[model samples]
Target: MAGLAGTGLSGAGAVGMALPAPPAGPPAQVGGLRVCERGDTTYLLDRSGRVRSLTYARLVPDNRLWVRQSYDRAGRLTGLSVSWSGFAGRLLDVRGSFDARGRLVRESGFRARGVTTPLGSYLRAVPRGLTC
Candidate 1:
């Protein structure tokens, strides 16, 4: 499927069938992370209005992800991960997390979907991730 390939994930069937795309309306309100579209980029903004990460919402029909960026509290890009949503076996993951000093310390989950992240990822992270 076009949506599956959009994630940069090889082997569409490898990950599993992609779920039909969620209706693209306004970007979903995800806790302390506010989403906004600037050109083709979808950015996840921290409460202070700094860019915490940038994500792509390409292929609206069955949205997928390219590369995901995560920032430290100091506004440094700390980690990267591939998140996918809508697949029959879609994964919710953090990929990695770093300390305020920007050092990778602990890791939680990973599925390797490479598509847009499912809500589980945010639900799991933002509760503790968002500070200030």
Candidate 2:
């Protein structure tokens, strides 16, 4: 049986899974940030030229997810926020503050309009290690 790497599905017989390729065109420099667009998602680079954050939208469910990240001068993520929308305009928002080594130091959650906390699913969708 084949196993997937980094997806936590090891030994589950999953195989040949890969993330979609980024947009084919070159990234454009806007102000101090580099912007790359892939379909409905836009990735933003921090001052250190790292992919610091992104925002994506889904049409099928008519929802959107946005990630905000802050990095110190050395390019290590120090703060992160992952937020998503639900039906009826509800929202689930979570924040995480990380230490110098990227270990989460504090976590906070907020809800508006009685939305379900799909925080786990949203975090899983994120590119791992950037979560709270």
Candidate 3:
């Protein structure tokens, strides 16, 4: 076994996937962000600089899976979301806003069916552990 274990499921309506064993160590940091990897999975730290969100890519169809964290301006985490896209081509749209204190006040999401949506009234909140 590698540093991880995975389940391979197949047959009727079954999806085959790989699940890595968790990493061992304190979280790693890059710039102001903390980084972690479980096999091929990646994670980001919160403003308190703790691992708060994770992302992984599917090995079979080679799709991207995203796990994200939201935070207030004061550096407190407020919310989180997860999304995925496949080889057939898909765009994921997730939107959320935070208060001055960094608390997420509202959030909304929609699937992009070959077209992007207008910015409209949605507000974007930067996650704590990301460079942007």
Candidate 4:
């Protein structure tokens, strides 16, 4: 359990794939990263090929809006938002904004009331300007 709702101060997620390699296809542009699709799921990758974001199908089959991400033209992350789909369509998490120099300005996060482990969750995921 990590933050669900702050400034981009948490989310120290490592750049790695959560699933197997996507099926072959020309890389699609996702914000400042390259995106590839595997069936209904899409993966965002940085210039170095690190994972950045993921968008997979929801109950609506082709509903790619279940997750969203944005970045500056130079590849700095600007926004990221998520929500469940259909009847359960509720916002799950968000992060946002970058300074003129492309630094993360602020993020949206939750308090994480019962989270114990400082791993995986935002508690352990320090943002760019802050020390954990």
**lDDT string, candidate 2, 8-122, tens digits:** 6766444565779878665677677777665655666655556666566554476766766666656666776787775666476788787898677887988786565544344
- Pick the lDDT winner: 2
Q: Quantify all predictions' global Cα lDDT against the true fold.
A: 0.58, 0.62, 0.53, 0.47
lDDT (Cα, tens digit) per residue for candidate 3, span 11-82: 432435556898877666666667755565575665564554545444346576555554443555566564
Question: What TM-scores do the predictions have?
Answer: 0.38, 0.50, 0.38, 0.33
**How many clashing pairs per prediction, in order?**
4, 0, 2, 9
Q: Which lDDT value does model 1 have at 18?
A: 63
lDDT of 4 at 108: 62
CA lDDT, candidate 1, residue 30: 74
lDDT of 4 by residue, 1-132 (tens): 156234444455533526678797666776677766556556666676654554544555533235555544454545555443234333234444556664556766532334232211221111232111
Cα deviation in Å at residue 71, candidate 1? 0.5
Which portions of model 4 show Cα errors greater than 4 Å? 1-25, 61-65, 68-81, 85-132
Worst 10 residues of 2 by lDDT: 123-132
Model 3 clash pairs?
Answer: 72-102, 73-102
